[model samples]
Target: MSAATARATIQAYYDAFNAGNAAGMLDRVTEDIEHRVNEGAIRHGRALFAEFCSHMGVSYREELRDMVIFVSEDGTRGAAEFVVHGEYLQTDPGLPEARGQRYVLPAGAFFDLKGDRISRVTTFYNLNDWIAQVST
Candidate 1:
């Protein structure tokens, strides 16, 4: 894949995310995709990814804003920086109680690409910032 194609793939993934289309997002990833959640465990495969998406669908509603994507010249790596504008819809285990609390947090994801699909996705954000925002 060319850098341009990788960038477009990342853009399309985020587009699917903002659209709340889990299947669309999955379609951009490899069958054995690796998902590294911020401050959480690394999950493998598309099925696990789908499970995570399902849980998140119930716990939060989010839109990625101001996204900017960068891809390596080799097109094997990519990253995106964005702000998450989100509402906490339900309480997630080991997290704060949710009564529709809303938050805006800066986040980013690093991707490892294979061909045209994402082989790995590792995401990051300020957990403390998120806690403070939703705690109040």
Candidate 2:
């Protein structure tokens, strides 16, 4: 994969997310993709990823804005930074009670690419910031 292709793949993944198309996002990842959730455990395989997406879909409605993507010259690695504008739709376990609380968070993700698909995704965000925003 070229750098351009890596960037495009990352962009398409985000586009699918914004479109609420989980299948589209899934298409960009490998069958054994490793998903490192923000402040959570690492999940392996497409099936686990699908489950995570389903839970997130029920808990929050979110859009990533001002995204900037970067890819390595070798095209084996990539990263993206964005702002998440979201509304908490349901109460997630161990989180604050959700009453449609709105929050804006700065987040980023690092990716490991294999061929044309993403093999790993490790996401990062300020959990305290998110908690404070939803708590109020």
How many clashing pairs per prediction, in order? 0, 0
Model 1: residues with Cα > 4 Å off, grouped in runs: none
Q: Enumerate residue pairs that collide in model 1.
A: none
**What TM-score goes with each of the models?**
0.98, 0.99
| Candidate 2 residue-wise lDDT, 22-133, digit = tens | 9999999999999998889999999999999999889999999999999999899999999999999999999999999999999999999999899999999999999999
Error of 1 at 74 (Å): 1.6
Model 2 lDDT, residue 71, Cα:
100
Give me the displacement of residue 44 in model 1, in angstroms.
0.7
